[model samples]
Each structure stands twice: as structure tokens, then as C-alpha cells.
Target: MPGTTPDPRSPHRGRAVRGMFASIAPRYDRLNRLLSMGLDQRWRAALVRSLPELVPGQRVLDLCAGTGDVAQALHGALPSGTVLHASDFCEEMLKRTPAKFEPGAAPRLTVGDAMALPYADQGFQAISVAFGLRNIESPQVGLAEMARVLAPGGRLLILEFSRPERKIFSAFYRFYFFRILPLMGRLLSGSEIDAYRYLPESVWAFPSPAEIGREMEQVGLVVREQRRFLMGAVVLHVADRVAR
Candidate 1:
């Protein structure tokens, strides 16, 4: 039962997520679009939609910024004058970032660990980590870092793959996710971690909505709402840093 997967005691259980992405960064975007059938763009747009609630001209942070997809999406979705800071630990992953941002938007890209963000306390109005938080080796520290960096009343938006609630859809998702995805990943990325194998594995290992809500609340982030999409196979978790 070793590879069967241990229960998720913390959100920071795997580094394979990072290693897998870095290894396949060259073809990451293409394969993502192909595998998700282009719905990933709409998912990022849904993540972008969360931006309007924040005050106009607010400061934004995109953690685990991998190629700046969320950052670029936010730049287009938010009001003008939003200060955007995008950060990722992998140099190879970040190398593809600038090209994704708007022409001349000049997003600040930093090579830094998510657990130890190099920024002043309470510095950002909104922080987003799309499909990236579950990969951190120390998610408690990473979540704490997000909390530490958020200004009073700032929002933390999280986008992640989730288990569908309905039994029928869950069965269908498992078939596609487990049986089909790994084969497609091998054909596309040529990754060694069985990258697609790790995808469903990580999603299964990730905390449920209630579990994540409790963890965020423990860190003083109030669980605001959860927008479930794709029959709950994906979730957008919205939390707000409490105003002091």
C-alpha cells in the first residue's frame, strides 16, 4: 500500500508536483490545453473573476506563478493600476512567464520559496495560487506566508482539482483521470514521475473543501465561499484575511 497514498495530514505533502512541472515545462501549456480540452483557460478566467471584489488599484500577488497564467489573467481581469507580483521557485518554470504577461505590464517576477516569501507583512490585497498550492513541501508555512503577506481584508483565491461529489460523475472522472490521463501524459511530456499518474494521486491526496476551510481558518483566513465547477471535479476556494 506504499504508493496507494497516505492520508493528507498537511497540504505540503509533495514536491513531485514541482519536479514534474519543471521537467515538462517545455510542453506544459500545450499538454494542459490538450488534456483539459481547453477548459483550463476558463478555469483561470474563473480565478480571474474573483479579482473584482478587491478594491481597484490594489496590490496582487500570484504565488506558484508557473508561467504567469494566473498573473496575466488577473492583469486583464482587474482594474487598471493593480500592482502585480508574480513568484515561483523554479527558474525553468519562470522562464516562460514574461511572454505570458501583457505587453509592457512589467510584472515583477521573483525567484523565491512559497514558504518564505520575500515581501513585507500584509503587503498584498489579493493572493492567488491556482493548481499550485497542494504541491508545496510545507504548505502550512506557505499558507502562513500568504496570510503574513496579505493586507487586512485581502482575499486569497485558490484553484485546485477536487473529487466530484456525485457517485456517477466521480466514477467517470476516475476512469478518465486514472486510466486515460497517464497514457496521454507519457505521450506528451515524456516525464519520468509518471507525471499524469501524479496528477490524480495528488488530487486524491489533497484536502477536501471542509478540511481546507478549517486549515485556512486556523491560519486566520475566513473561508468565504467555494465555487464548485465541472461537477465538483474542480474547486475555487475563496478566503479573506481578517481585518485587524
Candidate 2:
């Protein structure tokens, strides 16, 4: 299970996804700030604040750690002696991580896949993955792997786009997300591909918070909280690995 790759026959599959991220790696952070109108920063900040306090020697893993934003935030929040590790399948994205996040006490960075994490069972005390679950080849497999690497009672935080509950706002948000945002991202990132286009489609296809909660439960993670921001356009799902 740890080494399994996504189905090759799936259209716009994992390889395409990886290429798209690599193509847009340089402008990814800028587009995030611009497209989200800086709310992305606040969302991540809230997640950092919500994490269980870390003791010295504790380990936190930031999976799908694009550009190291969450990793940087966790590093800042954790005490000096705790270990912070960040991993991403896209080496380009990992390379683009700003040096400011990894000063003297740098977080260990690894190029890894979420569906097949290369860690022992219960290896981490806290794990966070932001805005990248939708890109995984199999979100269920990814979720299960998150449960696998987490210690008993460990925290798991997932930040991702979600459907708005309100009807009128949902319609408008869909228009902007499917049409306007893609155009803007295409122009800014200067990528001929459909990275921006794929983003909304993936998010739209992603399971709702409730469904995700059930999947987490199936993987032995208890849903501790589900917080919606920007009127449910974004969701932060927090869970705890159940002690066996």
C-alpha cells in the first residue's frame, strides 16, 4: 500500500498534476496571495493556533507541504527543540520554499507522496496538510496514510476548498472559481497548461466536509472539529488518531 501509485488510465492524472504544479511553482505563492485576497494566510494562521502544543522532541509532519507555508507557520508556533518536517511530491514546489522559513533550525524537507508516506506507524504527534489533498491521486488513500503515520491521539489538520452552504453565494462563488479565477491564474502563472482550471474542478469534485469526516472515521481518526471560513468556501477539518 505504501508504494502504490495512482491509476495510469485516469485522465489528467497524477503525472499531469505533478507537471502542472512544477510549471507553476515559481508563481504559486503569489497566485495564492492574489487569488485568495490574502485570506489564505489567515486560514493557515488559524490552523497553527489550533494545533495542540508541542513538547520538546515532538515531531510534526506537514504533508503536501507546498512552498513550506504551513511548515514555516508550525516552526514558528512550536518550541525550539521540537522537530518540524515538510514533504511534497513536487520537488519544484519544495525548492521554492522561502529561506526565511528555514533559518538556523531548518525543517527537514522530503520529496514524498501523500498516498504512500515513507514513515513508520505512529511516527508523528501532529500532521497538517493544506490545500493539497484534492491534488492527490486518491484522497481516501491519502487520508488513510495520514491516519497511519499519526501517533495515538495525534492531531491531523486538513485545510482545503469546500462548497459553500448558502445557495446564492455558492452559485456566485462557482462562477468566479470556474471562470474568473482560472483566467487570472493562467495569465499570472504564465503556464500554457490548465493548472488553474484543474484547481476548481478538483475542489468541486472533492467530498464534502461531512463525507470527509466519515472517511476519516473509517481510517480510525475521530473528527474533532470542522471549521468553515469565507462562508464555507474553505474548510479546516481537524481529527485525532484514536488510541488502539
Candidate 3:
């Protein structure tokens, strides 16, 4: 059903989302590049660029890391002594992350739920989620969890899909997002679950950037900056954990 908002607390919704990603795991990276016209990586790079400088031995977490694209990018950008962690609930998607690196070079990969992350409090100096927050069963719970693990003054970056402000461009983008993109996804990934169809629907149902910023503030994070790409079709939110 078009315009239907997902019920985040539904148990069935979690299982369905997990199943959808697992089914598309094989061609996930390929489909992303094709569907986004290779702009995804650039968007991630922008996220990385927004990070605050870190001292040696400080840690970073890439939550809901599918195939470790953001983790790999962070690995290259971080100081030599810094550690990086990559986590996702789907093992099938996470298992592919190591192949993107040489022996012993990949970020520590963990199969864990975003809402109930398996980590200690104040553990990470920085955290990032790329196009994954909206997929969480409860994005607010996920944000709180992220805040719990973040050190005071730690930064969090969120790269996600957003609606364009320009009316004419938004209409064209919606036509492609809701209609054409899913067709390409089904053709390319051969996914029976219609994962790509879920993509636009999720985006449409997601909160606006300002709303998300307010949510962050409620969870002990302060919005620092927001950078939009693809003419507001995508947005990167930069925030910091409030010092306790």
C-alpha cells in the first residue's frame, strides 16, 4: 500500500526487514551503485569528511554496517592507532565485509541488533549510520542506544534519504524513487521480497531532518551540522553527544 507508514514496534516488521536484507545480500552493493548512479560512495565520503579529529586509541563504530563501506572508508581516514567497529544484525550481509580488506585489516565485525547493541557504555568516540537508521524497528530506541555507547563529546553521523525541497525536482525524484528504482532493483537483484520497493516507502515514511535532529537532542545528542546531497534527496546529519 502506497503512503503506508511502517509500524516500528511490530515484531513482524523486524522479521520482514531482516528477511528482505538477507535475501538481497548477494547483490546489495551492486544494486546500490546501479540504483544511486554511483553517488552512494560520494555521499559516504561526505559523512567521513564531517568527522571531528580523533586522538590515538579512540574508537569509532559504524552501526548497521552493510558490507562495511563506511567502515572501510573510516579505516582509511582514521589515525593509524584508532580502532573501528562495524556491526549489523544480518550475518549474511556482515560476512561480506572482510573481503573488502586484506588479511587482518578489516574493522571488527559483529552481528548485533541496532536497538540492543552489544557494547559497553561510553565506548565509542564517534559513530555513523549510512542509510540504515530508518530500517531499525524503533529508530528512537536505536538513537538512544547509539547515545548510550557514545563518549561525552563523541560525534555521530547519519547519512540518509530525504525529500527534496524543490517541488519540481521532488516530483521527478519521487517518480523515479517510487516507480523506476524498484523495477531496476527487482530486475538486477532478482529479490522476491521487493526490497527496493521498501526503500522509497521507508524514505517517504521517515521523519524529516529537523525532526530527526530533535530526536537526537532528546537522546542526549546535539545537532552540529547537516549536509545535503543530490539536491536534498540525501542528507548527512552531524551531531555530538552532550557532555554529562
Candidate 4:
């Protein structure tokens, strides 16, 4: 997002965010497990569980697939006839995904940006993003694009970090997030771009769950359910595109 043509709405300029992610791709998953105490995996599982039941041959898209965790999970959970596609803007991150799926059931992987997705209108029955929306330059536009690609009454699942609700817990979480996590991330990834620091900054700056629900509604998606985890440090939002 850092190096692209200047857009006032995006938080990271084009290339800057992408470059940071690319730099850390090797150790990203390891660092995530260490930092979140492996809760990240459970959070992802929660996202999968929150989805509406899918029929055979239905299509689903996992944006910001990030080494294919969500994609793999979706592939495993959905009916055998369902189709899953995993996409991300960072090729290095995409490259980190392993060839673990059965030959025929592997998800179709693509390198693409979220703000301007390459999909056609009403192409998918469900779209999901996990912990990646905050990294986008303009989340509002990203959400709109996601809604655009979903069929009428299609599901949208988002699992993202959020501010903690408790005062004492919030203070402690901030201390660890801002102070401790960055150092660990740097040691793990060996990147000098302060990538981990950006994590907290972005989460703090991003819209709250309520605000995000409103944003979804603005783009013709209605929030159907919301769930919080890890004492409100993370949230899952399930929305449905308005039927025509």
C-alpha cells in the first residue's frame, strides 16, 4: 500500500506494507503462534465455524489468504464438492503456502490486491478475510469490493483484532502488543522496517467492530452476527449481502 499512487484513504502507501509482509513471510506463522500463544489458530477455527452451511459446488473466496491457513481450513471444512480460492497481493506470502492438499482438492491461489479485486460481480457465495483488512490501505473500499463480488444474500466473514473492552486488560494488552511483540517479531523475522510495531498501530487505528458493522451495512451487507474472543482483543463479524 505504500508505494502505489497516492490515495488519501489508504493507511500504508503502496509497496510499503507489501514489502514488509514479504520480508517477514518466512517466520510470519511462527511469530504469530508465539505472539498470540497459538490463539490465532483457534480464532481462525472460530471463523470457519461461524459460516453458514454450504452446499456442494458452492464457491468461496478467502482474501488475504496468508500462507493458505484460512484457505486450507475452508477446503477441509466445506463439502467435498465446494470450491475454494485463496488470494493475496504478496507473492512471497503466497509462496510460503505448502502443497499439502490432495492433488484435486487444492485451492486455486492468486496474487491480487484487495482494494481492487480481480473478480466479477456476484461471483462467490461467501468471502472471508482474516487479520488482513487492517493492512489494506483503504478498508472501506476493500469491504465494498468484497460485497460487490458476493451473490445476493451471500455471507461475509471477517476475523480481526479489536480493542479490548476491559480497562485493566486493555492497558496490559497494549503494553505487550506495543512493547513486547515488536521485539519478538523483529527477532523472528529479522526485518528492520518495524513491521511488528505497525501491527498494534494499525489495530488501534482501524475502525471498531460496531463501526465496521455500520460500514458493511453502508455497502449493502447486513451484519448478522458478531463474536468476540480473547477478552475482546479479537472479533468475528458475519454479514450477508442484501438480496436484490
- Model 2 spans with C-alpha error above 4 angstroms: 1-12
lDDT per residue, candidate 3, 29-84, as tens digits? 99899899999999999999988889999999999998888998888899989999
Model 3: C-alpha RMSD to truth? 3.1
Q: Please tell me which predicted candidate would have the highest TM-score against the true structure.
A: 3
Give candidate 3 misplaced runs (Cα > 4 Å): 1-12
lDDT against the true structure, per candidate, is 0.82, 0.85, 0.89, 0.85
When sorted by TM-score, best at the front, the candidate numbers are 3, 4, 2, 1
Instruction: Quantify how close model 1 is to the true structure by its C-alpha RMSD in Å.
Output: 3.6
> Candidate 3, residue 76: CA error in Å?
0.7
Q: How far out, in Å, is residue 96 in model 4? A: 2.1
Q: Pick the candidate with the highest lDDT.
A: 3
Q: Candidates 2 and 3: which is better by TM-score? A: 3
lDDT per residue for candidate 2 within 105-197, as digits (tens), equals 668888988889989999899999999887888888999999989999899999999889999999999999999998998789877776777
Give the per-residue Cα lDDT of candidate 2 at 79.
87
Question: Which 10 consecutive positions of candidate 2 have the poorest summed lDDT?
Answer: 1-10
What overall lDDT, based on C-alpha atoms, would model 4 receive against the true structure? 0.85
Backbone steric clashes in candidate 2, count: 0
State the lDDT of candidate 1 residue by residue for 106-197, as single tens digits: 57899888988999999899999998877777666788899999988999999998899999989999999999998999787856657687
Over 4 Å off in model 4, which ranges? 1-12
Provide the lDDT at 115 for model 1. Answer: 85
Clashing pairs counted in every model: 0, 0, 0, 9
